[model samples]
Structure formats: C-alpha cells, structure tokens
Target: MDIEQIRKRAQEIWEAEGRPEGQHERHWQQAEQELSGGGELPQTSSPAHHSATTIPEGRGKKKSDAVPSLGGEPGGFQPGELASKKK
Candidate 1:
C-alpha cells in the first residue's frame, strides 16, 4: 500500500530471519523494494549509519596488549581527600 506499510512488512521479515548477522544490506534493500511501489526510491550518497564489519569479534581482539594505564590504580583515589579541600 504505502511506504510505511511496506517498511513495516519488511521489518517483520527481517526480524523473522533470526536477525542474522550482516543483514543490514538485506534489510535496507528489502525495505526499499517493498516501499518503492514499482518506482525506484531516490538514492542518497550519504554513508550508511551502521556498518557490519564494525562489530567487534570475541572479547575484543585480545586488546593487542594491555591498555595504557590512565593513571595509578583505583585505590590511588584516597577516600574523602578531595572532599576535605572544599571545606
């Protein structure tokens, strides 16, 4: 029927398909197809908001070695020491 109706249908299909990984393209294309009504949806050159490869795998590639420490350990913050300064 209308664009909203078609998009709703396509979204339902996308959700039904196990919400599979790397399915953003499929979702966008299907949404356009369902909403286009035989006329092509105007294409935009703007980059897609969500990129598939950006999803990190595993616990995060092992961090490639420990992260550079910000400062000293957590206990370095002496409790109430900063609060004393305000008074």
Candidate 2:
C-alpha cells in the first residue's frame, strides 16, 4: 500500500488511542497490517458525526437472559460455606 496512506492511518490510530506515549512504532505497524488487509481497523469519527447508527440494536440493554439465577446466594454458596469444598 501507499506509504502516505500508512502514515495517515497510523496517525489516526495513534490519535484514537488518546495519543499515548512511546507507541509510534506499534501504531505504524498496526496501520500497515490494516492497510495490507491483515485486519479491520477501528473506525474513527468526530463526536458530531457519531450517532446510534454506529451502534448495534440493544447496545445498552442489560442481557438478563445471559445471566443465571443463583437463588439469592452470592456465587451460589451459603453464607458460612467454604468457597472450595475438600473431597
């Protein structure tokens, strides 16, 4: 790919990461990999242009179905029971 494109993408990746210190090489390599079709790069956008369109449906909804009930006991253990039982 183009060196200029890699440079631009690296700059974007650096900025998107909050401009951390001492990460130039890492960002450059990541940009190169993404540009070379190694992986998809995260999309960056201005706050004004960011909207719900970028988020999937039920993005903020709590997924109760994914959680299993523990019968009101934390970790499914009684208050005085040992965390690990001996054989």
Candidate 3:
C-alpha cells in the first residue's frame, strides 16, 4: 500500500491503542491488515479498536496482554479448550 494510506491506518491504530509507545511495528502491521482487507488477524484486536492490555498506552508492551481469540474466550487458553465433543 502507499505510504499515505498505510500512514493513515497506522495512525488510527495508534490512536485506538490510546497512543501507546513502542508499538509502531504492531500498529503498522494492524494498519496494513485492515487496509489490505486481510481479514481477521490472529492475536489482534478486532476493529473494535481496543487493546486487551489494560496497562495503559505508554507503560510497556503497548498491545494488549490478553491473548486474541478468533472466536473464543479472551485471555490465556489451552488448545484443547476448543474440543467440540463430549464423549
């Protein structure tokens, strides 16, 4: 994508992230994904634009500490948790 488009998207992400620090890479990737319409990105917050981490923006590790679920409970979880049978 062009620099301007990417820049705009990145800025949006950064803003959604509460203007956090040191998350340039993450923000950039997220912006790219959204702009490119890559679809739901794993380990990424939905366009709801909220980071799982509640530690505020500029502390450290700007992205949410919570694990991003494609469609399950948020936060840490085991693989087997997705098992779909009860035998």
Which one wins on lDDT? 2
Point out the higher-scoring one by lDDT: 1 or 2: 2
lDDT of 1 by residue, 1-87 (tens): 576776676666566664555755766676667566657543332233335436565756553344443335643433335534534
- Per the 3 Å backbone cut-off, how many clashing residue pairs does candidate 1 have? 0
Every model: Cα RMSD to truth: 11.5, 12.8, 15.0
Better of 2 and 3 by lDDT: 2
The alpha-carbon lDDT assigned to residue 50 of candidate 1 equals 38
Cα TM-score per model? 0.31, 0.46, 0.45
Error of 1 at 73 (Å): 82
Clashing pairs in 3: 53-64
> Model 3: per-residue lDDT, tens digit, 1-87?
787999988888777656767788887887788778889753434433454645676687554456443434444344345444322
Q: TM-score of predicted model 3? A: 0.45
TM-score of 1: 0.31
lDDT of 2 at 36: 93
lDDT of 2 by residue, 1-87 (tens): 999999999898879866767778878888889889987755443343455347688676763555445547645744345657512
